[model samples]
Target: MSLIVRVAARGDGITADGRHAASAAPGDTLTDTGEVIPGPHHQPPPCRHFPECGGCQLQHLDDDSYAAFVADRIATALAAQGIEADLRPTALSPPRTRRRATLHAEGGLIGFTEQASHRIVDMRECHVLHPALFVLVGPLRALVQRLRPKGRVELHLTLADQGVDLLVKATLPPGLAAAEAITAFAQAHALARLSIDEGYGPEARWEPQPVTVTLGGTPVALPSAAFLQATAEGEAALVAAVREATAGAATVADLFAGLGTFALALPAKVYAAEGARDAHLALKAASAQRPLFTEHRDLFRRPLTVAELDRFDAIVLDPPRAGAREQIAKIEAAKTPRLAYVSCNPSSFARDAKALCEGGWRLDWVQPVGQFRWSTHVELAARFSR
Candidate 1:
């Protein structure tokens, strides 16, 4: 028998001899015949959809082992880039804390897609979603039934200050009858807001009051399909790390600033730039009274040049999964004195870190964040100083 050693980047278990096993957890043993024997770190998955639903992949791992796996992912990414830094302890978000998620509705079922398949898992219970968000699953299913939506429908749910904000993308257009049913459903559930996308952009069907999400201690109007951190705890962890990294800076540039996650939180005079129009406007409106400057610019298409970047005392950027390659190039050229990088994908982060390091910046430390718990996803906040 071979012992399962670690979980790979895609959630598959790797054995001692380097063979991958599906649905195997660390400490589990694989027989020569390919049967898996559960070990100490293995536990019964809390969700019945486990091993089938694509929502979670590491639920079989114990708490300690799961945390280790999350840290290892970051370590491996840095190692690949030949970049070493002091790695802080991994911060794992507790279950039932996920504030935003996208579920699929198709074939009379609504839930996450099945692992390695396009079929929906038809979620009966979700351990990761906040109770507020999960409670609407049944109501949404009922609404789908009433509307009899054809083909596949995508549902995006996020917890706002008022309540759950839902956006539905349906293949079939909602007629008068379907629209009435959606409105009734939203009213019955007391939803904060409900919108549907029928080829065009999302059109609000019900909104009793304004929908907003409080970020950096301020309430910003929530826009449909706007970017947000997955969990509140995870967002707090990242914010704390960023604050520590850029403490005492008088001026800070927040590139790729989505709705002012770091811009509004930082004490410095912030200059926030984002490509998304809605997010930029939301941040601008929320930061009108604060010492924050918001700009609607595409960083990738036209990254802030060295001259433009030199105006800030410190830089903090949270780019998408692809990482801020273009912006990091400018930052490298500028030799920014201080930088705090928040990333959801470690591979791209490491790649960018190498560029910064080669440009004479030191990779100080990284705070690993396991926001999407029980999954291969890894996020981190790192400090770079020249």
Candidate 2:
């Protein structure tokens, strides 16, 4: 029998001899008969959809084991680039803390997609979603049934200040009856807001008041399909790291600033840049009384040049999954003294870290964050100084 020593990046268990076993947890043993002997690290998955639903993969592992998996993922990514840093203790968000999620509905089945398949799991209970979000599952199902969508529909749910903000992506066009039914559903649920997306972008069907998400101690209007952190605790963890990383900086530039998550919270005067028109406007509106400047610019295509970057004493950037190669290049050439990089993907973060390291910036430390708990996804915030 071979012992499952560790977990791979994709949630597969790796044996001592480097054999990958599906659905195997660390400390489990693989027998010659192709069976897995459950180990101490293996815990009964809370969700019955485990091994089927694609939403979660590491639920079978104990809390300690899961934290190690999250830390190891960042360590492995850094090792790949021959970069070393002080890897801090992993911060794992508690179960039932997820505030944002996207669910699929089709043929009266509404839930996440099946593992490696397109079929929906018809979720009865979700262990990851916040109690507020989970309660809306039934209401969403009723809305889908009333719409009678010919094909699959997507439901994007986010917990807002008032209540859950529900967005339904329907396949067919909504008629008079469908619209009335949706309006009633919103009022019955007392949802913060409800919007529907046909072929074009999402349009508000029912909103008693303006929809807003409080970030950095301020309420910012939440545009349709707005990007937000997965969990509240996770957002706090990331924000704390950013604050510590940029402490004492007089002026800071927040790139890819969505609704001023870090800009408004920082103590220094912040110049925030965002590409989305709605997000940019929301940030601008929210920063009216603060010393925060807002700009709408696509950082990927036209990253701040070295001259533009030099205006700030420090910088903070949270780019998408692909990472900010272009922006990092300019930072490397600039005289910015400090940087706080928050990333959702470790591989890309390490790649960008390599560039900064080679360009004279020191990789101070990295704080691993598990926003999407019971899953293989990883997020981190790091500090870089020149």
Candidate 3:
């Protein structure tokens, strides 16, 4: 038998382990459920839909509490390798920093999934996205409703400097034709670019245009398809952190230097290597006329040799999620003196940090940047000395 008992949670009941507690009171024991349920007030996000909506689990937790969660994770990972490091307080981007999101486009109507279920939650307003994108949601939905695209579409809404970029990946059925209509809608809304993908398989039709964004009052552009940190302030914070970690350095090598975000910010003579031609071009364009120069090439396939490493005093890496394992291996072989590693994934960062320590380097400091807020993600910059 189920009872409508009030949960201790502020004003709503609580759910545990995917099962609703018989009562809504805190620390209530229900024999029917055969479990002890903590009261609602003890839980975060007193909303009745909390346990259902996957949107925010830490709503019940304050910022200080959440900072502890991230700190523990980082501390544990570092302690395992006999490294002593402090996990600083987390930094967050202002509300609506999520410039891009992939919403499900079904039957020409776009929507996002509910917290825990595949059930779509038709949303005309997203709180975490930029205002420019937020305003477009309604118009975009109206356009989709009119078009009624045949198959489920992956609609990408990006915040570009000049305007928004709308990328739609879907197949359209005859009679419900709205390709030109969609493009016209975007143009009418003053969107910067509107790209559509229509192919299938590994070779999908996608755009290779550069994603231009103005950072620090300067236009910084990179391949739209390449990896980019989500938020503007987040990227700026990362650049600042890396600069703080590598200050007073004489010569530096920025491996996997995407757009030279770190290299361009540093005063040292930097040797940047990017895997893509587009990124390399943007980086060169940014560094042109300046004393700093870059080489267009891949870093992992053919890493800098020991003799090559002799040209630089320190190395800073901002590799993709897979991390700079190959480049680290080369540095280990070369016995590089100092290094600074920036990563979005802690697990990969820990692994590479271990490799560096084993190769005669010591962990100096670790700074955590809460780039992606309201999510279980962390970004960090670690300094090491040989």
Q: What are the Cα lDDT values of the candidates? A: 0.90, 0.91, 0.66
RMSD for all candidates, in order, please.
1.2, 1.1, 6.2
Instruction: Give the distance in Å from residue 179's predicted Cα in candidate 2 to where it truly belongs.
Output: 1.5
> Predictions ranked by TM-score, top down?
2, 1, 3
Better of 2 and 3 by lDDT: 2
TM-score of 2: 0.98
Pairs clashing within candidate 2: none
lDDT for each residue of candidate 1 in 1-386, tens digit (9 for 90 to 100) = 89999989988889978988887889899999988899888888899889789999989888888888888898999999998889999999999999999999876689999988999999899999999999988878777876777788999999999998999998655468777788888898888999988879999989999899999899999998678999999999999999999999999999999898899899889999999999999999999899998899999999999999899899998999999899988999895699999999999999999999999899999999999989888999999999
Number of backbone clashes in candidate 1: 0
Clash count, one per candidate: 0, 0, 17
lDDT of 3 by residue, 34-144 (tens): 564443333344444443444334444345544544555566667777777756566666557877666765654456666657765566545456788778767777776
Off by over 4 Å in 1: 172-174
TM-score of 3: 0.79
